[model samples]
Target: LIRGGRVELGDARDLPFTIKRSWARERLTPDVHPGGFVLGCNMTMHRDVAARIGYFDERFGAGGPLRSAEDTDYLVRAMLLGIAVEYVPDMTIFHHHGRRDRKAIEKLHRDYSLGNGGLCLKHVRH
Candidate 1:
């Protein structure tokens, strides 16, 4: 899955930072080679990766700090399963990060609290 708010579509030469283009511009270069080039782009992620590693844990809401790590945890699980995450430098989109409104935040807090409790119960039972 694409991470973070900023995204663009192009090769590394067109990047705002110093980057090398020829090195695996449309693939996961860092996983393949330490010195290989990298690209930052918005991707419509293929479903094959999730077909094995499972989907995001919707239990955590955005407001809770620990909730933020849920995505990281999912990505880590994906990497453990030997899924190759490719960074397509030629296609990108800038995401707009949105915060919840006050009411939304309050509702999220309640949901998050219940979700964490459920998680604890599951672990305890397991």
Candidate 2:
């Protein structure tokens, strides 16, 4: 179990943003199981579990068209394999790459959608 957020590098004015605050709060008081989603930047897994799951998928991550959902795929596989996933609110990491502008945020959302669709096709197709 782990949690994390983005922090502006060397920017005193950049406080913890709304999304990060929401993530922290959600981690502290999860109304549902934390396995609903996996935050890749803030995730931790046991070595045994990682080995069993064979780690993250190589197709989905940053610097690719998929752009995300590798963490989602890993967590889904872990759950299917009967691994218990927990969220530790205290475990946090600062992500140096923060999207500050509207254009970047839009692109992120777009990429996330694409990655999510890809995940669905990979796991849910029958």
- Predicted model with the maximum lDDT: 2
What is every candidate's alpha-carbon RMSD to the true fold?
10.4, 4.4
**Model 1 residue pairs with clashes:** 42-92
User: Which candidate number has the best TM-score?
Assistant: 2
Model 2 agreement with the true structure over 14-111: per-residue lDDT tens digits: 33332232334443222343323446666776676678888578788786568877777776676667676655555556655555677776777787
For candidate 1, the 10 contiguous residues with the lowest summed lDDT are 34-43
Off by over 4 Å in 1: 1-43, 59-65, 98-126
Error of 2 at 2 (Å): 7.7
TM-score of 1: 0.41
Candidate 1 positional error at 82, Å: 0.5
Give the lDDT of residue 105 in candidate 1: 55
Name the Cα RMSD for model 2. 4.4
Model 2 TM-score, all chains together: 0.72
TM-score of each: 0.41, 0.72
Give each model's whole-structure lDDT. 0.42, 0.59
